[model samples]
Target: MTPRYSLSQIVLHWAVAVLVPIQYWTGGSIERTHHAVHMGLSPDPWDVIQHQIHNYAGIAIGALMVARLTLRIFDRGVLRISARGPVDRLAQAMHFAFYAAVIAQAAMGFVASYFWFGIGSFHVLGSRVILGLLALHIAAAAWHTFVWRDETVDRMIIPRRTSS
Candidate 1:
């Protein structure tokens, strides 16, 4: 059995990890920094700038998601989590839901931007749902690390040894 994720997969995983928080920060920052924009009031220059940043970040994430999905399809080295019991099946389902939510959220944001010129309640709802999913993911990691005494998370991390 493969013990580790491919370097590309690891890199992409970390990339998304970094990008997601930035996405949320920028998404919310834009709103808080200038709520008037959403109220149809005169737009502030800074608001436009921040909104642009959020838009670009979302686009970049979307592009990265596509690349990640492509790599997932082609990379045969991906480590499979063997389904040992109910927990394993639940983990698999959670993984699928996470990926689907991410793709759908990105699509929703893009569509909202294209048609409404800004994000709305639907995009915010998606963000909240994704946040909940992320919490579950982290909890699962903790469970593997503490209760299961597994090296699952370690497999996704970069090796400490330089001589790999």
Candidate 2:
């Protein structure tokens, strides 16, 4: 049976998806509360804890992305969803955009970590760009899943069936 994604691909996809959100949540909380805490505006400990989570999660996500891309380039298990028509083609385009955006965002996060946040705070230009792209990506996925009633999202998340 042909798999929608090789075991490795599926694993990486889900892993990265799960990690990205954690990183985003932590990073965003830190960004919002950092200045306030420094200025004694808020005494919530959420900022410090979230910042650590963000930093660790970012590193893990970045590493996972590298592995995912490497597998994509080197292995044949990753398949772009097969398009049935113009609308499917459009969906495929959007999916491709999501993949590209994620990679770019991860790269930016890595660079930003080194350049801006000093590798500890997890502040990076990439995180901001990632937030915007993630918003767009999620919106597109929702539109495809609910509004368009397309299988694009399912094909990625669910295993595909094969004919004998």
Candidate 3:
């Protein structure tokens, strides 16, 4: 049997998974408002609410990412997955890409808040690229479960029995 991810690993994974989509939605809401105002259209009054939510969620995600990084570094039980095989290499690459994209997006949002100097938005581009990678990641996981007959995704999922 494959060793399962630690409890902290599972929690952090799900936490970020939930927060990222919410981050994207809130960022889109703000971007839309920005565009509408730029185009001389009246902005929706509720946009202010969305912007506030985005701001708070961004800060929270940033903090959680920091914690996630720390935990990842210290974690010794992360799935080894057949040492240096092609799929393992691809998974490693995607993991690194995710970390970079997520950190860049969060940092850009933070800096943009204080330094709005007519700079173009990277949120849309960043989100699209990251989302594409995420889709690939999901497809790979499905392949492992269905085609490869490996319990890869199961490592990340919480087990029903603690002492199994």
Candidate 4:
């Protein structure tokens, strides 16, 4: 039987998942708007809209990450599919990396926008790290689904109707 994530877990996971891409897709627009406003020029309306989405979505991701972590702490007996091996350790490390990268990236975005601090430079690196982490995560999921023939992905995708 495949273990399934809690419904709250699944919902929060997909919510943040959906918002992360919005941040990436609209990232450029925020930069353009920032520069345009700084240079005493009128920013494009579309850029402004995209920038707003980028900002709000970033906040949403940060909030969702926090909520996910909190829910994880309280989500005892939740179904986890791991082999208790080196792969499991690596997976844990990857998950930690994801949490740190995303939280820091969002924090730096807030600081860089609201303050004169020099942390803006690092946010770009954080974004690239996020991209790398995301790629690795997707690859692992694909491996689990196809190469490994594991039903691990099913846990998040499908909820078991019968209670464990």
Candidate 5:
């Protein structure tokens, strides 16, 4: 069988990885630095710009995730877990939770934007959820790589061929 993630999947995976950090950082920064109640000091215009970029990036990430999920469902290149071992089961559960969190965070971000900010939210509660899930996802990946010494994370990053 195939040796690695499809080019599209790999690209999407990395793209989301890069974008999510920016989304989280800017989101929190904007909320902290630009609160109307702040009596300390106003945020610079760049902070405002970063907030805008963060908002847009949220939408882009959400769209890309939806596309990734669609492709995973339709494409034959996506691999399945090889066994039902404990680690494998944990990986499967984490993967499912990651997808669900992504969807939920994206939806919430959109709604927060519309309700809280207006015209740009795009249902972004999912974005906040994504931030939390991302931390868990990364920790799980590290565990799989460093502690479990499994090929699961490696497979997603660089697939191994299966004997046919």
Candidate 6:
């Protein structure tokens, strides 16, 4: 039988999925707030709220990544492919890269917020890298769903209980 992710894992995965986009959407607001602060002027009320959302959501994402990684390391029920192949290896690599990228981005955002060292451009570049990774990840899922006819998407979308 194919191993499937546990219900708790599925929930965490989706939670991060939801928050990632929120971070992207609020990315611009952070810049605006940063600009105002550096300019020695009060930030616009709406920009401040958006900036807060970005900060909190980013922190949440970082925390969630920690939880997700901890579960991944300790959980015995995570999906495991029985057969090893090139595609399988690629998929595994992509997942690892994504996990690392997200965690780093979150930490970077926090540190940058407090002590930005004119690295705003670097942050923007990192965000773009994340976007590219996300797009590839989604593409991979779609490929698994359609081309491979694998249940990869289904696994994350609808988890099933395993018998003890």
Model 6 residue 164 lDDT score = 75
Candidate 5: tens digits of C-alpha lDDT, residues 29-68: 5675557337677777777788788768878888888878
lDDT of the candidates, in the order given? 0.78, 0.68, 0.74, 0.83, 0.71, 0.84
TM-score of 6: 0.91
Candidate 1: where is the Cα deviation over 4 Å? Answer: 29-41, 117-119, 159-164
Q: List the pairs of residues colliding in candidate 2.
A: none
Please tell me which model should have the higher TM-score, number 5 or number 6: 6
Better of 2 and 3 by lDDT: 3
For each candidate, give its TM-score against the true structure: 0.82, 0.63, 0.82, 0.90, 0.74, 0.91
List model 6 lDDT by residue over 1-164, tens digit each: 44578788799899999999998888899878878999999999999998889989999999998888887878777665444889888888888788898888888888887787466677778888899999999999888889989778887877768687
All predictions: root-mean-square deviation over Cα? 3.3, 4.8, 3.0, 1.9, 4.5, 1.8
Give candidate 3 regions above 4 Å deviation.
Answer: 35-42, 77-82, 117-120, 159-164
TM-score of 1: 0.82
Cα shift from native, residue 71, model 5 (Å): 1.7
Q: What RMSD does model 6 have?
A: 1.8
Tens digits of per-residue lDDT, candidate 3, 13-64, equal: 7888888888777776777777788999987878867877877777777777
Record all residue pairs in model 3 with backbone atoms less than 3 Å apart, i.e. clashing.
none
Off by over 4 Å in 6: 81-83, 116-119, 162-164
Choose 1 or 5, whichever is better by TM-score.
Answer: 1
* lDDT-based ranking: 6, 4, 1, 3, 5, 2
Instruction: Kindly list the per-residue Cα lDDT of model 1 for residues 1-164, writing each as its tens digit.
Output: 32777787788788889889988767865565456755878767766777788878877777777777777667666666688999889988887787778888888778877777355677888889999999999998998889988788897895323233
> Lowest summed lDDT over 10 consecutive residues: which window, candidate 4?
74-83
- lDDT for 20 in candidate 6 is 92
Q: After superposition, how far is residue 140 of candidate 1 from its true place, in Å?
A: 1.1
Best-matching candidate per lDDT: 6
